[model samples]
Target: MRKEKLKVLLVEDDRIEVLKLQRSIAKDLDNYELTLATNGKEAFERIEEDMPNLILLDLNMPDTNGIEFMQIMKGRDELLHIPVIILTTSNNERDIHECYKLGIAGYVIKPLKYEDYEAKIKAIFRYWSLNEFLNY
Candidate 1:
């Protein structure tokens, strides 16, 4: 049987961070598709069209924040099943707890160093690949 190529939707406003993540994912050259959304509103629009297998959301967007976005996602029957991972720079306890309450699959804090960020991205890939829920 052939494996399905995973599609990942990234919601982030930081250009530099986006570049870094793209580079890290490029290293593996795996069977994956990446889509970017500069803000929560754009993410929502894209989700409405066709939802990705997974979502990497940042907590502090300008138009709409990640938490608010998650709330809306939960309300939509079509989007509710897609797993959401909070990948952000925020380390606030309240934000973390709230994300869990909102049913985030994972919460990852952005690392300061490029190498660390790369490792984190790799780790995410590894984890998702091994996770039974993904049903590869």
Candidate 2:
């Protein structure tokens, strides 16, 4: 039997960050499909169309930040089950605490070094690949 590819939704506004994530996914991960959204509103729209297996969210965006997205997602039963991991540059304790309160699957601080960032992304993919999740 062939395994289905994991669908990932990446919500980020920065072009450079999106490029880095694409590179990381292309280089370090396999058996996955990625969908990109520039901000929370875009991501929400995409989710309405087709729910992804997981979401990689950035904390800062012009229209809707990560927290706001989470808040919106929390109210929807269909969307609430999807795992959302915050992949952001912010290292603020308050931000971390707030995300946890919002029930994030994980919080990752974006590393400055390219190699470190790649390694972290690789680990995330590997772990999620092995882990079990409910079929939607």
Q: Mind giving the per-residue lDDT tens digits that candidate 1 earns over 1-136?
A: 2176577899999999899999998956566678899998999888777768889999999999999999988988878778998999899999999999999999999999999999998888767656666663
TM-score of each: 0.92, 0.94
Q: After superposition, how far is residue 12 of candidate 2 from its true place, in Å?
A: 0.3
**Which tens-of-lDDT digit does each residue in 1-136 have in candidate 2?**
2177778899999999999988988954467878999988899899988888889999999899999999989989888889999999999999999999999999999999999998998788777766677343
| CA deviation > 4 Å runs, candidate 2 | 28-30, 134-136
Clashing pairs in 2: none
Q: Could you tell me how far off, in angstroms, the CA of residue 43 lies in candidate 2 after the best superposition?
A: 0.3
Candidates in order have lDDT scores of: 0.87, 0.88
Model 1 TM-score is 0.92
